[model samples]
Target: MKLYSQTFKDHKIVFIFFLFFLICQGFFSTKIQYERASWSNVPKAPARTAYVLSFLGDEALAHRVLSNLLQNFGGSGGRFVAISDYDMDTVSEWLFLGNSLDPKSEYLPFLAAYFFGASQDKEKLRPIIAYLEEVGVSGGKEKWRWLVQAVILARFELEDTDLALRLANKLASLWRPGMPAMMMQMPAFVQLGMGEKEASYQIMTELLREEGDKMHPNEVNFMVDYICTRLLTPTQKESDPLCIDVP
Candidate 1:
């Protein structure tokens, strides 16, 4: 009787330990599911620039000053703002008088591009990109942080998925020393395109085990999985992860 009781106690201890381990693992995995996306930090600009501009500069003076400069200057912040054809001993006043960067300066390129050009010309988008890039926000949250998103949003807002995808691909390509975002999400696209539900999540089983997109190292694993999930077909029943070839 004593021997049986001791053996039963040992079995109970082992089962308790096993349960504890499983519980810990579950909590840790759940914590990972709610992290934020790296792209979320950056965002698109709103259509409220006129208010901002009016608050920052003399609205009337700025407008009047902009009109004269554009007639001849082409762009406001080019190297020669003061010289009306600087050191023009052979000439006179500049036909255009755009914005300057400093308090005494103006913002012609930004103004002209944002206020007038962006709607009619896709090329106008370059200045926004260029401004972000020049300000050293190409790959970070501070400056170019939300630039790609903004570009994509612009394309989408214009009802142009083609442009949005083009911009997304470009940014993802420049994932800066890494694979394109679409490639990693390729399985999802493939699953959705081929109409597979189980296969979609199956790909996640493998990817979740590995490290995530290298370029955007800060990416949340579950979020990556979520993106893949977006591509899953809605019609299929759910099940355990399968051994997908990802072909």
Candidate 2:
């Protein structure tokens, strides 16, 4: 009982002292979270701004506002690029800005496009591919950028037979070592988009053979449904002769 009493007293004294410290800090520190940016009180920078603002940004206009901040904090050559490198995880957006500001930046737009699905707008992808073809890829890491762009374009269902075949060949060569299992499923989609039914089936069956695991009931059910959904869309009969790909 005596030991317990001493422990309680010690904890109580610590808690009281900590509360007093917090009260002192509160009186001296600026309440930055409630303060907004203005002429007299412009924020130093978004990342350097208080924690609350950074946390608030992801949902509340973060992507766009960050773009604006990067633009305002000096151009791509200076602190803006530094801020982007230090603060942002998705380097693509700032890369887009960088590449646009300096045409020589080969990787930024491609990286951004990959992260933000920048090529989803088919019209935008045309210019991106044109830029790539003109300036060309940079580093060893950059080869993957074009390969990824090609694959992304294929997924958009924009590329026809020749492009699909070319991309498949490139992916085969470049991606053989680190072949992400999920991507093997893509050839089926690409082949089907090209109206090659038998080829699509063969590729998809290969994917199933390699990746399918039914040890868990949930996994089995999910694979079954995912495969079935792709294979049996209402517009195409299961026995349709024109297709062989994942729907």
Candidate 3:
């Protein structure tokens, strides 16, 4: 009983000191930890400002905005998806500004256009392609090539063949020495888009004749078979004397 009383007395003294220390510290110190999101005071400026800033040697900022836009479109995920119309417009405006500021920046505009073509609606692709053409006019060979790649993606992946063909023809007309011969395929695509399968077949036939020796045997055979298949549909073969046989 005496030992227990002494232990109680010791604990009471320690508790009183602990309480006193806490009170003393609490009076002088204030600790507040809560969930607060990071905030930036910098406004998301308008495209005009962004354009002006980029034109005035702030190209890095433009790149940053482009990067942020790409992230929003799920570009970081390796497969971009369509965004809302308003967000698309915002991203497009920023892209126009960025490309307009640095016409020679092939990668940014090329990537933006490719992602846009993959993810954007057909209604908006026309203006985007027009903008790319305008930029390609002054963006030199490398830029033009990249823009052409973006158009091809739109053609095959986005099913926007008409727009892609239009851009392709424009790029072909502006052909540089290093430009690939694939640009010439635009005419075939144009014919296909217009429901003129015969014209497309003729174009493919000419391509095979002109480039057959240069292409791998397998590739050549593939092209010939593809053309023949399209030209020699079962229903049309009976009446279609124009069907050219491959082999």
Candidate 4:
């Protein structure tokens, strides 16, 4: 009976120790997980040649892998990381590296404008916007749409009308013969938003003279209405040829 009692006591102690160990392990694991969930760090991108070499000299494969990694960088471990927690300058560097690897890919630009650009920290958007502009300009007509997005991020997201107008002007400079009228008229729109109605009027007038046939009828009518009803005085509207019947 004594021997049986001792064995039972020993087994009970062993079971208690095992339970205690599991509790401690769970506590520490939860602590570690909480800490990880609370903070995130953005790592700098590797050099271009080193990155390509790491992927067995396949630049295309490198770009694809890097893009995927970037998309999920701060959101791993089943934890949510706030966009504001990221160091956007470092993020911009990674984006630039990705672009260098594949300028033809729209992946990075899309991520830059829509994903990272959505952050509430508007100032951080500067570098990302600049990256978009660089890619948009260098990538030519096919990529010019990114410039439009950048202009939007600057105008509405960043609330920097001047920057928006500057990007709009840059977009205008890239305009070709068959391009959309909205692309060429982006500056005037930005100008109107900035309350530069006269400047906007002058731009629309030039567009009417230069590209009227190419512009859609709705676009032309909207411009004419804006000029006659909103911009010109009653006396000016009476004499202006475009405003003659625009009442």
Candidate 5:
């Protein structure tokens, strides 16, 4: 009977302790749910070489995981977080790290260009633009799209036409076989935006002469019309063969 009594007491003690734990857990959970939440800055990227090595040399998996984490970091905990609230420097680092892990994946660049690139704080876009530019330059023909995106973000989002022109020029210089003709014409378009009519004319003229056969009919017509209507005076258009009969 004494042993039985002792066993019952032990069971009762465990039950009471478990009940207390539940009560405390519920209290803390309720308090935490009601507590004011603040936006947490994005964490700094880990050392690239070490991080990849730690993933058992599966760099692809490492970057994929990082990409997912970055996408979720902004909207974590079911909270609405603005892009402006992010620490762009750290975000840039994270993106760069992701790229280093998987240079071929466009996922990180897409996020850099569209997601965080939409920040209302225009200045914060600089790092993102820089990141995209690096990806474009290093990625070469296969990754030219990132550079194009960088130019767009610089021109429209940041309203920095000079920087846009510089990027456009780089993109034009890097033009390769099989690249879209429209993309090759970015420099001329940017030049026109900056009111450099002569430069734009020269670029378009060179493109038409060298790659006109590769361009679609609509693209060629668009270029001809733009050059004739926008870049040249009526007198010049009348004499220029490319502009002749161009409406």
Candidate 6:
């Protein structure tokens, strides 16, 4: 009887230890995952909805929330350190999801594109440009201007001139009366980048004439002079009006 009682006590103690170990293991696992999610900077839905993400799936509201979150993530101090490569990737993923929720909204894509451009991550910027290009195509004629601006940044800042020119050509074809002149001028700029100086000059000359036809001839002269002075070198050779290199 004594031996049986001792064996039973040992078994109960072992069972208690096993239960304690399981509890500790679970607690640590939950804590680690929570920390990971926190550092990831992805806003999580509440548990009452069974974490279904139904609440966050609202398009406009989700965009607003994402804007606020991005602002918070972009702030100074401790947050700056948290915005590492991994964190940036995670934030971009969140932005992508937010855009998916509100694909038609100009706010989210533009806002996220600005952030991604500042990131200087070529991989990240590609997707942003792609998304905005789709927006430019399907949304409205007005949105093409935004797409042009994004593409210009890709060309000058990111040095992705091929995509930039392609987008610039796309936007130029859709140009409207009220749209910005830069939309029409971007293809010329891309041509300059591609070492086609004469082609760019001719395009710019044509663009100046088009602007002059719009009843603002003097205003258009300043634009042409600005483009030639800043982007091209003046030469005594009138035959080659705008040379890529100084004569």
Better candidate number, 2 or 5, judged by lDDT: 5
Candidate 5 C-alpha lDDT tens digits along 1-247: 3556657665787899899999999999988885545666797888988898888999999999999998988686668688898999999999989988888777888788767887989999999999999998895435776787788778767878999889988888787777667567887777666545665576568667756785457657866886899779999999999987796
State the weakest 10-residue window (summed lDDT) of model 6: 43-52
What TM-scores do the predictions have? Answer: 0.23, 0.30, 0.48, 0.65, 0.71, 0.50
- Comparison by lDDT, 2 against 3, better one: 3
> Rank order by TM-score, top first?
5, 4, 6, 3, 2, 1
Error of 3 at 59 (Å): 3.3
Which regions in candidate 3 have their CA more than 4 angstroms from the true location?
Answer: 1-57, 73-86, 157-161, 192-247
True-vs-predicted CA distance for residue 43, candidate 6, Å: 9.3
Give the winner by lDDT: 5
Candidate 4 stretches with Cα past 4 Å from truth are 1-40, 194-247
Candidate 3, residue 244: Cα displacement in angstroms equals: 34
Among these predictions, the greatest TM-score belongs to: 5
Model 6, C-alpha of 135: deviation from truth (Å): 2.5
Q: What RMSD does each model have against the real structure? A: 26.0, 14.9, 12.3, 10.6, 10.3, 13.5
- Tens digits of per-residue lDDT, candidate 4, 33-69, equal 7465544478888999899999998889999998998
lDDT of 3 at 52: 59
Q: lDDT by residue for model 6 over 91-117, one digit each (tens)? A: 555655665556655555555444554
Global Cα lDDT for candidate 5: 0.80
lDDT of all the models against the reference? 0.37, 0.43, 0.56, 0.79, 0.80, 0.57
Q: Which run of 10 residues does model 4 get worst, by summed lDDT?
A: 194-203
Give the CA lDDT, 0 to 100, for residue 3 in model 4: 59
